[model samples]
Structures are given as structure tokens and as C-alpha cells.
Target: MSTPEASAVSDEVTTYIANRIGFIELERPKALNALSTGMIRGMHAALDAWREDPDVLAVVVRSQHPRAFCAGGDIRFLYESFQRGDEAARDTFFIEEYRLNHAIFTYPKPYIALMNGVVMGGGMGISQGAHRTGGLRVVTGSTRIAMPETRIGLFPDVGAGWFLARTPGALGRYLAVTGETIGPADALYAGLADAYIDDTALPALVDTLRSEVFERGVDVVACVERETAAHKVVPTPDTSPLADTRAFIDRHFALPDVAQILASLEAVSGCEEAEWAEQIVGVLRERSPLSMAVSLEVVTRAEGAMADCLRRDLDLTRTSFAHGDVVEGIRARIIDKDNAPRWRFARIEEVRADDVAQMFESPWPAAEHPLADLQG
Candidate 1:
């Protein structure tokens, strides 16, 4: 049997019509909308065309699945790349992925993300980089946002570091370190979403946006905002559940060392949100220590030029792949479902400075910052 995407469209043209908002929906639901190489290249090509097309004013990216907009990078394909040791494939994917994020950040025309379902890792990359981050009229709900990459021995990529790093207080550090799941309230509070609406309203919104045969001056964003307002459910947390978490997050997560942060969390007991702190306590303990260390360090330090973060991330990812944990972590956590990882260090406290510090070191060194092509 062919894949659902193969059955639906060929040459990566997944409904490339330009009625109103140039609409391109990711339809590979069986993979939970995990982005494939084809999907990435396809999106790049479509967006490149739309940027030049006169009639296309905006773009509406959607997926057929109600459960997830995008869970993350297609690990199955990534696993293949890892096994084959395909350097070119790895570099192309990252370059394209980073390019996609940059495009969303700088798209000339108004770009909106209908973050209607589960979005994480790569999902967060695109959604957060939306021209309208925390945009006014998202078509999904609070229940669908999460960033659980740390548990699988991976740091939050797809601009997680960039977006989260800029969030108020230490929430970015907290979310990246813990890989905790948050509802719409927490997601919005952390600036992960703009507005939260139910999935039922999505179809009509898509139709209204797409089917409109109109003058070029139609304000798409305002229309979406007004139309989507009736269903708006801004997550109103009582006390920014993120407050206590962010304080503790900033305190320790900002420490110079990852092991130090782990020890600090282990010792933290009397803080205000002690219960939630303890609750996520087990979560931090279970995540890959190496990933936690790098995520914390890179995110804190990934300032300066925007391109630098992507460049640094590529190095970190390549190094992480070479390290044994991603393979073992995926084996235990995803493929075999073993849930028993013989980590390089089982205990977070046992994770050493050098162990975590090495993830930032690049193999290419000074003359070759894998992303030099960014010099445009």
C-alpha cells in the first residue's frame, strides 16, 4: 500500500491552489504529520513560488489530523540517515529546516499558523517562528501543545532554543530541560501560542480563508482574528503556574553547569511551588542528562546573530547523533519500547561537566561553520 501522501498527491504538491491564502496542508497523518525530506523540500518549493505569485497574499499551513499538527522530525527517516551515516542528507535537512524557520520569521506577506493540535520539536520550530507568534487567532486548543524531546535524548530544536530562550524569566529553560507538557494556558503564558480555539472551527476557517475569491486588499489576519474570536479561549492560569517553575528554573538552570542544575533541583525542597517542582522532579531525573545539559547551555548562550543559533544547533545535533544516547534512547524509548536506557549516566547528579560540555564543540571547527552558505 502506498503512503497516504503518495495516494493523495505527487511531486510534493499537496493541494497547491491559490484562491485566497495560498494553502498547503500536510496530509501524512499516519506519521502524525512528522515532516519528511519530501515534505520539507515540498514546503520550500511551494513557499518560494508563493512569495513571487501576485495573487497569493498569505499562507495557511494545516494538516488533516485532528490529533497532531506535527509531532516532530520524522525520526524513522532520521534513523535511516543515522544508520547510513549520510552526512549530506543530514546537512541538507538541517539547512532546509533552518531555512524554513527563517522564512516564517521574515515572510513578506502576513503568515499565520493554525496551531490546531499537538506541536513539538519541529512542530514548535515552525509554529513559534510564525510571523505571528502568539498570534491572535490560532484555530486549536490549549490541550495540544507540548515539548517532550528531552526524554528521548534530544534537545528541543526547530527554534525551541530561540523562542524559549526569549520567553519571560526561566520558563524557556524549564520547558526545555523538563520536556514537560502544558495545556493552552501554560502554552500561551510561555508564548508558545497566540490564541486557542477548538478543532471544530478549523474547517470553516480554512474554507473561509481559502475559498474567498476576493479583491487583493482583503485583510486576512483581521478577518481570521474577528472570525476566530468567538471561539477564543485564552488560557487564564490562576497564578502563572509557570511563575514558581520559572523562578526555580532560572535559579538553577542558569547555572554554569548542567550537573550543578541537577544537584540544585535535587536539593530544592522549600520553594513556593514545591509540589510542582517535585512533580517535575521525576521528569528531569528521567530525561537524558547529556541532552538536558546541552539544551540548558546552548539556549542560555545562543544569543548574538539569529543564524548563530541554527549553526550551533547543527553542531550539537551532529555531536549528539555520534554519541550513543540518541540510538540507545530511541531504542529503549521509541523503537523497542524498552523504557530502560542504560544511559551514559543513569543519575543526573552523576552527569559530569565535561560530559555535558562536549555537546557544544563542533567537528568542523573555525574555518567551516557548517552554515556558511547563510552568507546571502
Candidate 2:
């Protein structure tokens, strides 16, 4: 929306200003703007400055890459750092990353995320929080969003428990375990996206936003919505299996436990939608058992404010780093590319209730917790 700032350009993220709109563009087009530690830290600094700068009336976030706002975090770098025993880098990445996410969630100014393309994992972490917190979240036709952490031996962290718990029906559980992709329409239907703007129209939309005037008493999100309405395209027909299977998903995933959820799926394996049930069953069977178990607990127990979920996730993430299926899953999915992770538990049934309970334990005292400052 804005011209590039002479002083704010960076290798991964660029910041600029035009007509009171501060723009943050993901600059790592090669990595699909996958977030690195430096990128998150830069965002923190930029946001801190913009939040105070009177010239900046609003903020706009998009990516230089036409194909992806952000694919995810730089997981390969995280994997290498973990393998090298550099816990500082890994911990710093998560700590600062989560803090930035919280800042975006609670930011007072109008923060707009033009989610143009592949928004997943850490990408979802940053943008989804903004969306949930009354920010301007616009998705384009190129948008393909998901929380595919189960595939990588991770639960949906980054306050996933908070947002996913709020999705329609059991769709959150269905998405968390299956790693399925959803389009703009589905994203809006599921409340993960606010509006749909076609990718081709973004330049004009950004220009309009750049030149738009803002007043102190006006609602910023509503103002953007009204401006974006002219360019909003009617999304194509909904063919997402998530929508079609909602009844089944809500019915089965309503169960509290993952093992029971599997049993519920198996119970319906002989029904009219037997193939669909079996297919989902196969998906669950393929994911990391420990991740599946912990994810269920996180989603089910996520019943409070966003800060509450993040605090819980902080514990889950730390425990996951110590003893969960992350290393093996990362090895198979990222390091080795084998797609064959030897999980600590062989099956969903093998993942005990106590195993999940262990992951929820706070590693630090409540007063010393990294995310303890976040208030509802």
C-alpha cells in the first residue's frame, strides 16, 4: 500500500509509509516469506515504533511474493538449530514469536493482514490472531490456509487452542489432525478469514487503503471493510470436504478423547459415508500419536481468553521439545524426507491420558512463566 521506506528495508521484512498507512511486507519471496527469528524480532521493533508514531494511522501487512504471504516458520532452520543443541535460538524464536503474536492480537491500532497466499503454521499464528482480535483480515483467491502441524509432529501452538476452539462445530479438531487445506470461502465460513478479495485486485485495493483518510472516532476495521467491498470478488462455489462433512465431523469430533474419537469414526465406517469416515481414520492413523493426543487436550481444554491458551501452549511446546514426537516427526518430514516417523507411541490407543497430562505441566513457576505477562 505504501512506498518502501528508505530506512526500514530488510532482507526478510520491509517497512514503509504512505499517506499515514504503515506497510509491512514479507520480503523472503524465495522462502515464501517463511518467518525467521530475525523477521519476528524486526516485526516487534517495527510494531512497537508504529504503535507510538502519530504519523502512522494504521498498519498493513502483506507479502512481496504473489504466491505466499508466508508458507510457515523456517522449520528447517529450527530443526538444524535443535540438532546442533542451540536451544537459545529455538527458545528465542518461539518466545519472541509468541510475544509478537500477542502484540498483534492486542494491538490498539488498525492492523490489516492481506493474506494473499499460503498461510500456514507460523503464518497462521500471526495472521489468525489478528483476525480473531477484530483486525482487518482479507483473504485472496490465492489464499490456502491451514494448521498442518500434526504432520510435523507438533500441536497447533501460537494460541491455536484459543482460535481453533472457536471454529464452527468440531471443524477445529478435524483440521488440526488432518492437515487439510482450505480456500478463501472456507476460511471465511470457518471464521478464520474476514473477507475475500481477488488477488488481481490487491494493488488497487492497497492504493485505495493508502490514500484513505482516517478519523479518531471511526471504526478502522469497518472502514477497511467498506473500502474493500468494491474489489471483493464472489468466491467460487464451496467444494471443501470440511463443509460437506461438517455433520459427521461435529458428531464424531464432539467426543472428548482422541481414542474415543477414533472409535467413533470406526463406528461409522460401515455407514453410507463409510469411505469418508475411513479416509479420515486413515489420516489420524498417519499423524504423530503424541501430537494427536496433546492437540485434543489443547483444543478441548481451550475455554478462556487468548492469553490463557498461549500460556497453556507455552507449557505444551516446552514439554513437546523435551519429550514429545517433534524430533522424530521433523526428522521424517523435514530432515530425512522419508514421511515415516517412528512415533514413541505406535497408535492413538497407545497414547495414554497421562502422556497428554504430562505435556500440560508448567516447566516454570507461574510467576516466572515466559508468557505470564499476558492478561485477558
Candidate 3:
């Protein structure tokens, strides 16, 4: 085996090859490894470079931050871009970010994501692709994952709807509308994470990947499975509240729309899950009504391949920025820290179905769509 030399892929990302494994580390700890346009481009470039490199049999994505694998996209950057009327820059970020997501989804080799902490929004976009690509998504006790875009008046983008929709029963819809934060046990139960390793053991796992030798034609996935299984932490019984509330979630979330879902939750009475339903109702009330409605539609429609979902995500991204409450959401939640957003609709019932339908309509023509090249 040869000693590996690390090289800077960009200011926020680093790439290296060691022991037949390629490693990409997110380096922006100050911002909790938020994905900037540059980071997205750098990651895509690294994957493209290693796609056919025989020496590199697999790729591992991790972060330098102790508190986050990646928080999400650079929302503050997008907020400022919108403030400055830099539509091109704002549009380019989503375009490139979604393309990077597509690359990860379709990567031919093993792509492992060490999801240690704060995997949300754009973070979920990058890491969740491993589940479908025959790769590994390793979570830790510190991992706190959510697609909490609805909280910020934005729908979950970056193919989240696709994966969220595939979760058991109506868990996807419940998560999409309420933007709940779930721990590792729930993540595994929801099919979002593959293994739960103690956070303390992550370094040893990475070291093993970097130093262990393998015979010819050895299975990389199995090698990972063995290493991770050694450190996997079994959850206590009934650890996942998401699992406990599955009946309530499925009953309400499977309704025809967000309005009916909330109404059903409000009507819950004398049941063991009543408290959970009420809490979820309160969460939905705070989120942008339009965003919740749009997200419900997005998750409901995300029934096909990842590529198709990415295409629709791009469309929603464009529409959300252009005509939805995303700008105000970011303004209140991130920029101002005011924690009060004057949403487009004061109540869920006020959100018009036509407005939600308009978001799914692409601004660009079929051939001219930015992600049109992403085929299933």
C-alpha cells in the first residue's frame, strides 16, 4: 500500500486517496460544513475524477466539524444573493447543487457518508443518496437529521421528497409537513440511515478503511459492513418515537392534502398518540402554510427515479425562490433571527391549491430545463 497525500479540492472541501479508498472531507467547521456552490462543485469534481480510477475502489464523505456532518446549504449566502437581486448566482447554486446530488445518486462505486451530526436540508440531499446507490450511510448517537425546510418557509429540495416519500407508510408526509428532527434510531427505523455506530468509534472505523489491506476482488461494501457492525450500537427498545406514532402518522398524513391532515390531527381525542398529534399540529402551524402545502404535494408526487425527482426539485427550487415564502422564511429564521415570519397564508386553510399547483409548473421549457440531462 502507498501513503496517501491530501489535496485541496476547494476552500471548503478536501480530497485524498489512501488504501484504495477516496476520501472527501467537508472543512467548513465554522459554518457547520454548509454546502456552498464551491463545495458542491468541488465534491462533484472529486467524484468525477475518481469514477474510473481503478486504485480507488470506494469513496467516503465526512466532515471536520465536531457538531455537524453538514448543516445544509449556505442559506445566508442565498439570502444575501436574493437581497442583492443576484438571481443568476442564486439560480446557479441550486443548479450545481442538484447536479452534485444527481452525481452522488448515480455514482457507480461505493460511496459512504459518515453522518455524525446535524444532517439536515442540503446535508440530507448529499448523504441520503447512499441508501439507494448500494453505499453506506453511517449515523452516530450525535446524529440529528431532518428535512426541516418547511420551518424556514421552504419545501425540502435536493431529492429529499424522493427518499422521504419512500419511508415506511406515511412517515414521509409527516416529516415533510412537520419538519421534525429525529435521532439515529428513528433515522434507521425510517430507512434513512444504515448503521448506528458510537460517535467515539468513528475515528477507528475511518482508520481501518485507510489502513486495512484487501485481497483481489474483495467486496468493499461487505468490508464496511463488517467494520461498522463491530461498532454498531443497538438501540434500546421503543427508542424511536416515530415508530410509536406510526399509526397516527399514517392515519392523518395519508389524507388527500395538508389541510385534511391537520384537521385530522386536531380531531385526535383520548388516544395514547393525542399528545404527539397535537405537538405536530403546533409545528405545522408555525411553518409557512404555503410551504407545507407545497411540500406535501412534492412528497406525494415524488414516486419515480431519483433523476426525475431531482428534475422536479430544480423546478420547485426555481419557483420557491421566485414566488414562494422562502426569502421571508430565511430572512426571519436565519438572517434576522426574529423567529417570526409573516407567511403568505396565515392559516393552512388559506393556502390556495392553485398556488401549490403553480409551484410544480416549471419556468423553463422541457429541453431548456437545467437538470434535463439527468435521466433515470
lDDT of 2 by residue, 1-376 (tens): 4554434888899887776767888999888888999899888888898887887777778985798998888888878987899877887788888888888888877788999989998888778766645576789889999888888789888886678888999988777777778888788878787877778888877777665666641355666687667664444324555677788889888888888889988988556778888988998999988898888778888888878888887787678878988888889988899998998899989888888898899988999988889986
**TM agreement with the true structure for every prediction:** 0.88, 0.94, 0.96
Clashes per candidate, residues 3 or more apart or on different chains: 3, 0, 0
C-alpha lDDT values of all predictions: 0.69, 0.81, 0.87
Q: Which stretches of candidate 3 lie over 4 Å from their true place?
A: 215-218, 232-239
Candidate 3 displacement at residue 27 in angstroms: 0.4
> lDDT of candidate 1?
0.69
Model 3 collision count: 0
Which residue pairs collide, candidate 3?
none
lDDT of 1 by residue, 1-376 (tens): 1112211254423746455456667777777788877787777777787787776667667776687777787876666787798968877787788777767665666667777667777877666766443233263663466668778887877666877788777777777888887767677677766666677877787767655544552377766776767775544643455643566677766666666766676776776656755766678778888778777876787665556777777887788788736767777787889898777777767777777768878888657775755521
RMSD of each: 4.3, 2.1, 1.6
